[model samples]
Target: MAILKQDLSFLKNNVKQVDAEMFTSKIRGIMDSHAPQTSRTVTDRTSSPWFSVESKAVKQARRGTERKWNKSGLEIDKQIYLYHKKQVRGINLTAKREYYNLKFSEVQNSKDFFNLSNELLGKDKNTKLPKSIKSELLPDTFGDFFIEKIEKLRHTLVSDFNHDEDFDDSQSDASTLSTLSPVTNDDVKTTILSAVSKHCDLNPMPIYLLKNC
Candidate 1:
């Protein structure tokens, strides 16, 4: 943070003259210098969202103990491994319970409540249509259906058409949006502050860092 502040202080004098692209590059360079990016491969298997660092540590310890028990074939080692295994299970259950409890408390509407309920019940799996579905023919099918319906409706309307009916323009409501108010400095600040703190490859720095600076 101190480094960020110090680097950003240099921008005060040349803020007006600095080009947008150059400014972005400079900020990105500073960020990369302090926090270099690293890559990791993702797999299909994922950890539970409720799992914490403590749970991971305990699980790792359990694995170590189990390995020792397997190697030594000692009764005491087996008991210690069992103890750690139970601790991991208990921690996982407690974490899951607390996580769902908090989620249930924060639900504001029936839709959200039902969604959370489905998540808890493991019923929120992605829905996919069968491969046998003739999706390629759907556009033509939809076009034909709509065309036939519209043709029938058009014929019915023609039979019931009243050409002598007079329209009343005065019955319509009047509305006009001639101008928008200019955005103020406070509005800009508020928008930046309210923006999500997510960072992407294109972003020079995270919004949280921008806010702090």
Candidate 2:
């Protein structure tokens, strides 16, 4: 195609006769005729490459058992779910280890290693600030950003007190119950929030808002 394009008479006639769209399509057709389409769709690329067919089948089975566990009143139903869950976990772990090992074999340097690591761990591309947000108050507003992180951490770890009992029951079995001092969960949350407040609450909200604005 490059050689064909080089003929002076051909180039002059081609441009004179073909519209822009037709010219583009001809070039594209030439390229596609040589190579198969290798691009992945968004959904295909977003899913874990380590997840194999066997792993997917095991995971499907696990989810089936989880539904059974949720609806059935029998302890045996729950036991079956646990068994499937373990099988799924084991298969996924082996798949991921093999995946990383395969990647490790291909890497030749620190840059390659880091790139592969990012592929495995995922990059924080979604968390970036907008490119237009170039605020001069960013330095002084650091306090607000830090406070937001603290609030998110607190909310995620402790959650609401109303849901604690059910969450605890779901996580515990007779053999796995905590053996620590009989401190109530609510009490612990209160202690943590109080400590956060002692340090954070000393500053007035207006001061942070003013700096941020």
Candidate 3:
């Protein structure tokens, strides 16, 4: 295009038929008016080498390399990414099937509590809980831990009555007939809420407001 323009200008100037600047301006205007528009759009330039690489380089020269842009920005480890994926899916922690029922029993023993806690901790590890989960013994919140403990007790009680090698129907009937100690359950809940008060609570006013208003 530049070569053609140069050739045209030479011929026009030599013949002295038109003013060079005026003729060039008129030709440019005509070409611009008649020409189909370029296929340039914002989306087209998004992946362009000039914008993606060159412009990024210029920006990085002025600022530091972005921690969220290219390879350097998204340098998250595989474990971290997997952990975040689980979190996005709302898999907060894992637990076994019978854990809940056992925790609420009167006959749940200390051994059962340990087993339940271990299983819950294993699940947390599977969920990619941070090292903080291990170091703290109990997690940051007490509600989950306390509930697990209570459930373990219930399981122990049921197991003792149902699964003992010397299990007698008469003895089993007596043990199984026992009800949960409300005091024990309440104490466990209190301990849990004390630890996780900020994360767990209910405002009773909502129900009252709904009923009245």
- Judged by lDDT, which candidate is best? 1
Better of 1 and 2 by lDDT: 1
- Candidate 1, residues 26-46, lDDT tens digits: the string is 887887888888899978878
RMSD of 1: 11.2
Task: Record all residue pairs in model 1 with backbone atoms less than 3 Å apart, i.e. clashing.
Answer: none
Query: What do the candidate models score in CA lDDT, each in turn?
Result: 0.87, 0.68, 0.48
lDDT of 1 at 128: 66
* lDDT string, candidate 2, 55-168, tens digits: 989989999988988888679998999999999999999999999999899989998998778877887535555455467766557778899999998988776654764575
What tens-digit string does per-residue lDDT give for candidate 3 at 45-95? Answer: 444221333344444443333323333445554444444444433321222
Instruction: Return the number of clashes found in candidate 2.
Output: 0
- Residue 110 CA error for candidate 3 (Å)? 77
Instruction: List all candidate RMSDs to the true structure.
Output: 11.2, 34.5, 34.9
